[model samples]
Target: MLTSLYVRHFAVVEEAEIGFGPGMTVVSGETGAGKSLLVDALLLLSGARADSGMVRAGCERAELAAEFDLSALPEAREWLRQEALDEDETCRLRRVIRSEGSSRAWINGRPASLAQLGELAGRLIEIHGQHEHQALLSRSHQLALLDAYAGHAELVQRVRRLAQEGRALETQIRALQGEEDHASHLALRRHELTELERWALAPDALAELEARQRRLANAGRLAEGIAHLGELLDGEGELALRRTLARAQGELTRLVALDARLEPWRELIDGAAIAVDEAADALRRYLDEVDLDPARLAEAEEHLARLHELARRHRRPVDELGERANELRTELEALEQALAGLDARLAERDRLRRDYALAAAELGASRRAAAARLAADVSALMAELGMPGGRFEVMLETHGEDTSLDLLGRERCEFLVSANPGQPPRPLRKVASGGELARISLAIEVATLGKDSVGTMVFDEVDSGIGGAVAEVVGQKLRALGSRRQVLCVTHLPQVAAQGHTHLKVSKENVGGQTRTVITRLDEAGRAEELARMLGGLEITAETRAHARQMLERAQAD
Candidate 1:
């Protein structure tokens, strides 16, 4: 239930903090006095789109806040708990709209996205605008309302899910059946796989092959260079490294005999002579092992050329040839599997269709049962709302077996009505008058009350085309609904205003050369004066005041 609403710098409303109670609250004001501003504020708090024009003329932003009691709304409380936004048994929703057309929302003082605000607000309040009844002319809207009244959310959702699954299966079957040349495609893939497998494309094998090719290509240069190195290190010439070291060793050994410090130099020359002999031995082994055959070199070069040609033919880098081969093998495998499973998929599609049919039939039966009860209840309400001899019917047009299935099940729903006696019922859009439409819309809402879990319901002048006894009946129905859930109504009829458990009057005034809207909760005396004003227009006669008081007293007594 809504506890209070605070609005500041919103349109003509400079500032207003209005307290609300548990029952139906009616707001009344003269035309152009901004009576609907309260409803607008609630809409904004409920995550409606905001506009810069909603800000007061000289203000930079508009602020709107609504507080709700969650003790009776466990669903809303649980939602808050899930979102980590709960604060005790109360929920506060605040929205700020800047003059630049940007808006921000908060839930329980924590920043929130507009979608989060909308989701939480939907569980807390349901708002019906003045033009809501106009939607009744649409068959789709009528179907939705019927479903809502029937509480068929779960059943309808299940039927929709089954139908979607069946459609998806059909699409897959069609795609597989369309591939008529799978045999040829598979053969081509197999040929490509064979070609890729013929090459040594694995990373390790390719590295070893390239290394062998490099060694074969440079064998002659390597053998010649090593031989020259061997000659430089240990040849029999006088300038050879080993020969030069031998002479140095002899001279150093003689000098060492003369002075012991010379012995370390003689040892260094001997170590150098040994290193040169080892170098010469290694070169001799390398020259013997090196492959200097022209035939092997040609073979290595021709093999590398073949690998490059394979890379070019496949339009892939040499390194990626292995990956390409794997991809082709996988595709060939999948194509073969798809060809073999075509019959199985077709069978599955048939199974889904059968399942969808059964579920749709069950949903249809539920709708038929709910439609009868809803039509009876709405018809009874029509008579009480002054449409004597009126009848309402929910017509279900079942589709044929050949018709394609959709999310709306196998039947279309439409509302039919007869507003006068001795007349056959016709479609609501074609037969009902404006006043009749409004009353019928109200009857549907009244019939569907308590079906929704929302704690509060707001009607923004839904009583537009109604008056007199019918207006009073509308007010009574709304008031009765308030007994079960909180209701807020914006109305111009005294009959409706008098039926409120609480009354609020909206009035516009000019202060300091600026226009502002004010809302005040009405006491018994204040309610009488406001009702009298609504009843008598610009002049409030003594008789009108008495009549207004009596109406208020009578409505409350009822």
Candidate 2:
């Protein structure tokens, strides 16, 4: 609840601090007394746009601060916990408006933004006025109100969670479909990979084929060189080196036999003769085997050309062609497996959508029942507020069209109203008069109070229309509402003002030709005088005072 409010340097307010409690507090005075100015300051503190005219005439700036006790609001406390903004059990909201038309806002004494303050203020208080009939015009607000009234916020939350899950699953299905959509790419990749696999090129195979081509290109020259060497080494009739070495070996043996010291030369001669004979035999065999075959050379060149062509076709280094082929094969197989997985995922996504639909259906059913009960409750309260024959209705409509193999689950709900019997209930915007609408708005507030968690409800001229009994009933409702939270009502009706737990009289006073607004708490006699003044105009007669005292006594007794 709002524990305190301080206004400094505001229009006609100068400086004032008001203490609040957990019950109805009434602010009353004649016209132009700055009573509503207090409400204006509070609205600004709650994140309303600021106006430079609100600053005191002689001051450079205006400041407003309001305190809230959050010990009882667990939701707000948890939010504060998540944001790390809590300080003990209190939250302070402040706003400063400068004469230059600039404004600053704060929460918990730290610099803050208007949006932050507004978000927190929404949970802390609800200010209802004539302009908020737009909320009645909104379908979302209607559903929220009825959901709050029927105590089905939990189900609404469940449905929201399921909706989120369903959307996530649907996103995955879309991504899978995107992969499946590239069918042409998949087919082309498979065909290319299969062709590469069939070739099974080996590393350096191109270089090996090139080397064979070189060997074939020089085969005739190689064979001719070997045949000429064989002829010189004894393949033809000539004195070969091997025959000359053999004759020299026999002469050395004769000389070594004559001289015993010459035995090393005999051993050398024998080894040389053996080496010469082996060389002659190898030369004869070389001449026999050396022959050029152009057919085989052509075969080798063709093979090399084929290898080079394949390397060109694949657009890779010949050595890397093998690795590229292996990689392509792996990818093609993985894509084939991924397609199967995509199908499975899409099927699972379909099942998830069905589950979401079932959950939403259940949620819609609960909301339907809840809307009826809420309409009944608010209608009853409205009747007690003196609109005896008013009719209230809640309507729901479903969506159509199937998407992604599943139907979407959703519906629109509207609040309908009729001011009197024999009249058909239409949309709230079309059917309700200003007074009836204000009262209806209050009844809805009252119906949703326990679940709303707002610490204060400010009624701006809620007692504007109707009189006598209806006014008392409005006062009683405000009082009962105040039992759970604080309520501040601005009113001219003495009956409504008299019922306040604390009565404040706002008046305009002048000192030294400067007009200012003043507020004072009225005691019992003061209350009577005020009520008598309300009832009897400017004359305060003895009978009028008696009647005022009696009215006070009865009001206080209740």
TM-score of each: 0.70, 0.67
After superposition, the stretches of candidate 1 with alpha carbons farther than 4 Å from their true spots are: 1-6, 15-23, 42-50, 64-96, 102-126, 131-141, 151-158, 182-344, 365-403, 414-439, 450-456, 483-486, 509-512, 521-529, 536-550
Cα lDDT of model 2 by residue, 1-558, tens digit: 888889998999878888888788988888788878777877888788888998989889999999989988776777667767778889999999999989999889888888877777777776665544234456765766666666766667766776677677677656556664568878888776666665535756656767767867886787787666656655445576666766777888788789989889778877877876677678667656654678878887766565566578878775676787778878777767767687777777677667667767777788788888778987888887778898777888875443322222376778887778888888876643666776776777776664566678787777767678888788788777777778888887777887888888889889798877788888898999888987787677999999889988887788
Best by TM-score: 1
What are the RMSDs of all candidates, in order?
A: 6.1, 14.2
Clash pairs of candidate 2? none
TM-score of 1: 0.70
lDDT per model, in order? 0.85, 0.76
lDDT of 1 at 226: 91
